[model samples]
Structure formats: structure tokens, C-alpha cells
Target: MLLRLPTSVSETQEYLTQGAVPIGGATLVWATWQRDGFPEHAMSLRDLPEANTIEPETLGAAVVLNRIDDRVPEVLRRAASTVGTGAVRRTATVGGNIVGSTLRCLLPAALVLDARAVILEPEGVTETDLAEVVAKRQLLLSLRWNTPITSNYVKAAAEPGGPSPLVVAAALHAVAGGGTLLRVAVRSEDEVFSETAAYHGDAGETLSTLWDGSLGRLPVPARELVGRQVTELLARPGGR
Candidate 1:
């Protein structure tokens, strides 16, 4: 396969605007690629330093999954560890993960993190909510979030190494009036449900309500898993 290597962001943007696909780690693209169905033009982002830096409030799109553990939030790290084996993590990138899977894999944790995407488009650069970019599939440059809340995640799968049936994430952060704010996200098979509100001494209820609204009649097992994780998140340092 022919590859275009751009030495600078401008050159990379030029290639992107001309309909070239941007490749970070390229793990996802190569994994699902069919015979003779590869992109006509693919530009590698490895040479672009901006897409690989890990900052306090920003995670570049080309950051590999394994490096996320020490550089990113705890909840995000946990989700990244579950993507695949160690070798896969080494080659899979944050940007590829964001575009490859809708919300089931890493997006749930990112959602609770209040993440936003810095996208490099053909026209120019723009900042957008992470979920909004799900449909656009634009070229993401980095991810940014302000509030680093205490949060945790839980996933229930039918078998060992099988697909997760239910995945839930909950977070607690400071709000006005000296109270806490609760943000939760649930990733089911093909959908994602989320809710955020000022903590009024009722987090489990909000989670259950969101589940019921999104998927009618939450099963006992799913409820228990979500409850345990939410309980842990609330008990974390400075939570509630």
C-alpha cells in the first residue's frame, strides 16, 4: 500500500483536504481492511508531533492506547486496557479508537470525562463535542476536557473475553453551591445513554432512570453491576 508521510501539520492538512485518509496507529484500519478495498490515499500522522503529545487537558489523536494509562484519567485508562491484548494496545491509537467504535469501547469513559474533539477539517480547525463527531467521522487532532472528576467503569459480559452486554460509567465533580454533580454514561450493544445533573443525594436513582428510559426494564444483573460501580465511584477520593 502506498503511504503519504507529511512532515508538518499543514502538509498533513493539505493531504487530508485532498481526500487522503489520516492514519494514526492504523491498527483499526488495517484490521478491518478488505482485500483490494484499502483507501486510495492514506497519510501517516506519526511525523506530526501535535497529534502525539499528552498534555494535562489534551490527548492527541495519535497517542497509542498503552501510553494512555499513565497519561490519561483513570476511567479512560481502564477502558483502554480492555481494547485487546498488549500488542494491540501498543499499535492502536486514541484517534483510531474514537472513530472505529461508536461509543461502546472507549467513548463511555470519555463521555463522563466531558471530552471534546479538536478536529482538523478541510476548511479549517474546529472544536466539537465528542459525540457529535461520531457521525461526522472527521479527522480528529486531539481531545480536551476541563473537569477531571472522580469516576469508575463497569462492564458485564456473558462469557470470558466475549462481547460486553452492558457497560456503565459514573463520575462526580464539584459544582456550584458547594455540591457535587453527577455524570453517567451507559454503553449497550448499539446505543449509548447518558445523564448529568446536580447531585441531590440520588445517583443510583438517576442511573436506573436513564437505563429505563433508554432500555426498558433494566435486568437484575445489569442493575447490580451498575450499582456496584456507581457506589465505588461515589466513595472515591473527594466524591460525594
Candidate 2:
């Protein structure tokens, strides 16, 4: 197998056109390889400095998961923390977490935040909605989002710090009419894909409608439990 190290996005794009696959941290790449041998050519983004930095509104695709804990909003930080143990986080890249698996906690957080992705393609760079970018399987350059008024992430997992079977993330923004706009995203094990929904009204009403409309498909008891958890989270002072 040939591993190509590209130090810049342009170089990465060039290599990609030559049938090279871009890999960050290689967590998912290695797993796929374990199941179905290595590819003929692999491009590693580890040496690309531009892909590893975190800014106020942008997070580089190659940034390690652990690096985001304190640097980003609380919802995303909390989601990042649950991705795995410290060792796993140290080697997992934000890009990989976003694109590698939709089941991860970060995807819901990103969805609620209305994050967009900077994608690098052979043609050039293009910006697109995070969800759409993931659906297209585009090579991610970075993720960008504006800070929300408040946000919260809640996950239901089989074990402490284990991969979550269900994740719910909500972000709120104060509207001009003394009401709050709420965006919620839910990911569950039983579903083939995750979904995000939005509502605007009194917190209680919004939360109720969100639960009833988006999570209604879930069993009644399970839906009630998730609804309560999200309600309590948003009800906290300052959404702490």
C-alpha cells in the first residue's frame, strides 16, 4: 500500500484525483482496512497544518477530537467528550468523526448548530450544509458555525462513555418577539439515519412539539424518557 502525505489542500486535491484516498487519524480507515485489506494508495492529512487548527467559527477537519473539548461550545464539547476514551479521542479527527459515521454524538451537535462544511474537491473548494456534504461524501476541509445563544447535548448509551445508542442535541436562539427558536437533532440505533427538526415558541411548547413530531415514532415510554431529558436540559439555568 502507498501512503501519500499532503501538506496542503491543493496537494491533497491533486492526489485525490490520482485515486488516492484522504485519511485523517486513520481510525476508520484502519478499521475498514482490517475488514478488507489496505487500498492501493492512501493520503494522510496529518502534515497539513491548515487542517488541524480551531478558530472561533471554524474547526479544521483534521483537528483531533480531544482538542475541541474546551475550545468549542459546550454542546459540541460534551458530544466530543463522549466519542470514546481519552486515548481514542487523542487520535480521532473531527473530520473523521463527522463523515466516518452518522451514529456518532458529534453529528447531532453539528446539526443543531447549523454548521456548514468547507469541502475540497478535485475541481475546487465549495461550501455546503454539513448534512448535505456528508450525504455527498465530499472531502471535508473544515466546519463552520455561528455561536448560538445556548445549547445542550444529551445521549442515552448502553454503558458510561460507550458509543451512544441515541443522541439528542438542541440549540436555542433568542428571537426578537421574546420567544426562543429551537433546533433539535436526534440519532438513534434503530434508525438508518439521523434527522434534525426546528421549532419556535415558548420553551415548553417548543420542546413538546419537537418531541411529539420528531420523536413520535419512538416507543411511547422511550419517547417520554428522551423528552424529559431534553426538557430538563433546556430548562436548566443558562442551559448549563
Off by over 4 Å in 2: 159-164, 175-179, 190-201, 237-240
Tens-digit lDDT string for candidate 1 (1-240)? 568887777887799877887776776667566644888888877767878878767888888888885566777778888776799889888888887654347788888888889888877778998877877787888888765667787766556555565887777767756777777777765577777756556766655555656433456666577667777777666675
Q: What is the TM-score of each candidate against the true structure?
A: 0.87, 0.86
Q: Model 1 clash pairs? A: none
TM-score quality measure for candidate 1: 0.87
lDDT of candidate model 1 versus the reference: 0.74
For candidate 2, lDDT tens digit of each residue in 13-129?
889999997777787678779899988998877788777778767788888888885567777888888877799899988888888765556888888777889888889888998
- How displaced is residue 72 in candidate 1, in Å? 2.0
